[model samples]
Target: MTLHEDACRVLKEWRAPDGAQARLRDTYLAHLDAYGDGVWRSRREGHITASALVADPARRRVLLTLHPKVGLWLQTGGHCEPGDATLADAALREAVEESGIAGLELLPEPVWLDRHDVRCGGPDAWSVHFDVEYLAVAAPDAAERISAESLDLRWFPYDALPDRTDDAVRALVARAAAALG
Candidate 1:
């Protein structure tokens, strides 16, 4: 099956934790229903993006990258690529590419959904990203290297995320920790 079809099925079956998430889930489903190209970056209204929050198996800490453009300490995630077979695959690919940490295992399901406007790929490139967020567990001895996508990559304690992070990331961390326990 196509990745787009898988995404539609995933969102349709996802159990949103709150009314807010349910609404977003529905919106995502509707977007897909409305545009055959909904999952691609060319979708101006918004495009489906996939991302993952990487944490140690113990869940005590999370790996965050200092985004080159946004300059924010955030999780490893980004736009879906044609090579991706599913949203989860896209997120895993991005996490591995950005963190340089291989063999990371992704949670079977997504943990969060976030929609936000971005000024990525220079000035002319702008759009809202309907992000499907998942949690990935890194082995205890996993070594990380920084890629061109990030200025720095490091792990922060669950309760002590850096001040540069926003609520979306904080909420993802909280959800990821609970999922781990």
Candidate 2:
């Protein structure tokens, strides 16, 4: 089987019976604009995800999402849609919609940048390449609700993330943290 097919099989087998995994499947399919298919290679189509490195200057914490599919801590973001003119605006919209914190201001400049492939979840026909853009600032309020797309949302200290999360996520956090400094 191709790597894409193998990853899909593994995701199917390893997925939990919890209803949340179904949300991942549905969300992936619903957001088809993020992916594309080829004969032998599945590739992540260009997409936008708005990420906020919400740093509480007083508390010195960064907001992060406990993502449902990847099952790892990550910044809040989602696939861009026709409604969004630029990827940065889409990032801000996703962050606010998911976090429910208003009065957020995107940093004048992107703090960090990176890319990753969508390897698993939904159909394993293609990849979604996320051109992740990082924005920084304090959250509007502590009262925030986790969206359906995320299992949980909370803040973490820069030093504590490596021990508390996966390596890939840790790396992204580190990238954002360095830019924050």
Candidate 3:
């Protein structure tokens, strides 16, 4: 199946944790139905983005990047690429690319969903990212290097996230820890 088909299949099978997430899932499906290119970043209406929280249980921390554009500490994620075969592949690719960590054990099922506005969706000045969030377990000695996409990359304790961190990231981390347990 194509990547867009894979997204539809994955979202259809996913069980949302709450009414809010269910609503977002439905909205994303609707967007996909209306635009064949909805999964790609080129879609101006909005697009499906994949994110992964990198958790190191040994360190009791999660890796976060200070996004250069958003200027907030956020999880590893971004717009899907042509090379991504599945939503999970996209999330894992983002995690590895942004964190400079290799061999991450990614959980295929999504742990959370977030919708946020951004500037990258062309000149319309109105674009939303239908973010599908996943979790990955990092090796005990995993090292992180900052990518150009981020101003800085750091591992923050689960209990002590950085100031101005989005609640979405915190929620993703909690959901990830629960999934890891």
Candidate 4:
């Protein structure tokens, strides 16, 4: 199946946690229905993005990247690429690319859905990211390297994440921690 088809299939089968997630899921489905692959880029009014919360095998720490453009300490993720076979694959790819960590394994299902606005350079002043986030466990000996997409990459204790991290990130970490248990 095509990437758009695969994304639709994945979202249709995914079990969202609450009304907010359900709404985001529905919004993403609608976006796909309307825009197909165009929803993968910022050229559109909004797009679907995939992210992963990378946790250690013991779930005591998580890897977070300081996004250069957004300047926020957030999960590893980005715009879906044409080569991406599935949403989960996109999330995994982003995690590896941003964290430069090997042997990261994604959980079978997504852990969170978030919709946030972003500023893009073109005619559209801003775009919304319908973000799908997954939980991934890094290898026991996973070592991280900084990538061009990020200013820095670091492993933060689950209980002592950076102060700049937001509540949504904290929630994703909490959910990932529980899933790891």
Candidate 5:
């Protein structure tokens, strides 16, 4: 099946944690139906992005990247590529690419859905990212390397995430911690 088809199935099967999440799921499904491959990039007015909150095997820490554009300490993720087989694959690939960590395994289900605006350099001054977030467990003793996409990468203890992080990020971490337990 195509990535679009896989995404449709994944969203349909997903059991959202709240009414807000359920609404986001429905919006994502509608976006997929309307945009197809365009939903994967900023080429459209808004697109779907996949991200992951990566935790250590002990679930004590999460890896976050300092996004150059947004200047926020955020989870690893980005636009979906043609090589991606599913949204989960896209999230996992971003985690590995951004964190430079091996043996990261994503939780079978998504942990969060978020929609936010992003500024684009091109004619379109802005775009929206319908972000699907998953929880991934990194290998114990995993080492991290920062890529060009990020100004910095670090592992923060679940209770001590950076102050600059927003409430959504903190909530994701809390949910991930509970899932680990």
Candidate 6:
């Protein structure tokens, strides 16, 4: 199969029950195809980013952020902005900037690629269809610091994740647990 077909195939497997996943995959695939075109290319393109599954070794817990929007606990990440040449760098940068944790390490080499839409400044501002979400490991000491993007950040054991957390966040926790084993 061609690269696009291959990517689409994988996306099919990564598919979730929600229609959102299909939208994300379709949008990002288009971005990938139009990567070299001018002008609107940069703006329309989606970029990669990392989300740190920070763990507190001492406490045997994982660190999570309570996002300002969506209001559920999740991993920190944002767009891979103009300065980031690669998605991996963007992932790491956003993790640090949003999570207030330094020394994060991209782990499992970002085993997944997915897309999501980020609505900006209410309905009127620019909306971003982010070709995003890389998975990573933090330097174990990350639980000590928390950034402003989160209303609260803290460590929670795998078995003790808050009930209010989103399903996607829970899926990440499951993935992390499997990787560590």
Best by TM-score: 1
Cα displacement (angstroms), candidate 5, residue 89, comes to: 1.0
> What order do you get sorting by TM-score, best first?
1, 3, 5, 4, 6, 2
Better of 1 and 2 by lDDT: 1
**Candidate 5 lDDT tens digits, 17-94:** 889889989998988888867546855688888999989947488999998887789999988898998889999999
The per-residue C-alpha lDDT of model 3 at residue 95 equals: 97
* TM-score of candidate 1 against the unseen true structure: 0.96
TM-score of each: 0.96, 0.65, 0.95, 0.93, 0.93, 0.68
Q: How far is candidate 1 from the true structure (C-alpha RMSD, Å)?
A: 1.1
CA error at residue 100 for candidate 3, angstroms? 0.4
How would you encode candidate 6's per-residue C-alpha lDDT over 1-181 as one tens digit per residue?
4333333344445544346556765666565566532112245433333445665544556777888876788777765455654456666787777666677676534543444555444654444544445555566545456676778887789768998786667766766666565
The per-residue C-alpha lDDT of model 3 at residue 82 equals 96
Which 10 residues in a row give candidate 6 its minimum summed lDDT?
36-45
Best by lDDT: 1
Q: Give me the displacement of residue 158 in model 2, in angstroms.
A: 1.6
- Please list the C-alpha lDDT of all candidates, in the order they appear: 0.92, 0.56, 0.91, 0.86, 0.87, 0.58
lDDT of 1 by residue, 46-126 (tens): 899999999995649999999878878999999899999999999999999999999999988999999888975559877
For model 3, how big is the CA root-mean-square deviation? Answer: 1.3
lDDT of 2 by residue, 9-86 (tens): 433333333464455434433343234321122233433344565555456567788877767777777665546554
lDDT of 6 at 152: 86
What does candidate 5 score on TM?
Answer: 0.93
Q: Least lDDT summed over 10 consecutive residues: which range in candidate 2?
A: 33-42
Clashes of each: 0, 5, 0, 0, 0, 2
Worst 10 residues of 5 by lDDT: 35-44
Q: Model 6: which residue pairs collide?
A: 49-91, 50-91
Clashing pairs in 4: none
Off by over 4 Å in 1: none
Distance from true position, residue 121, model 4, in Å? 3.6
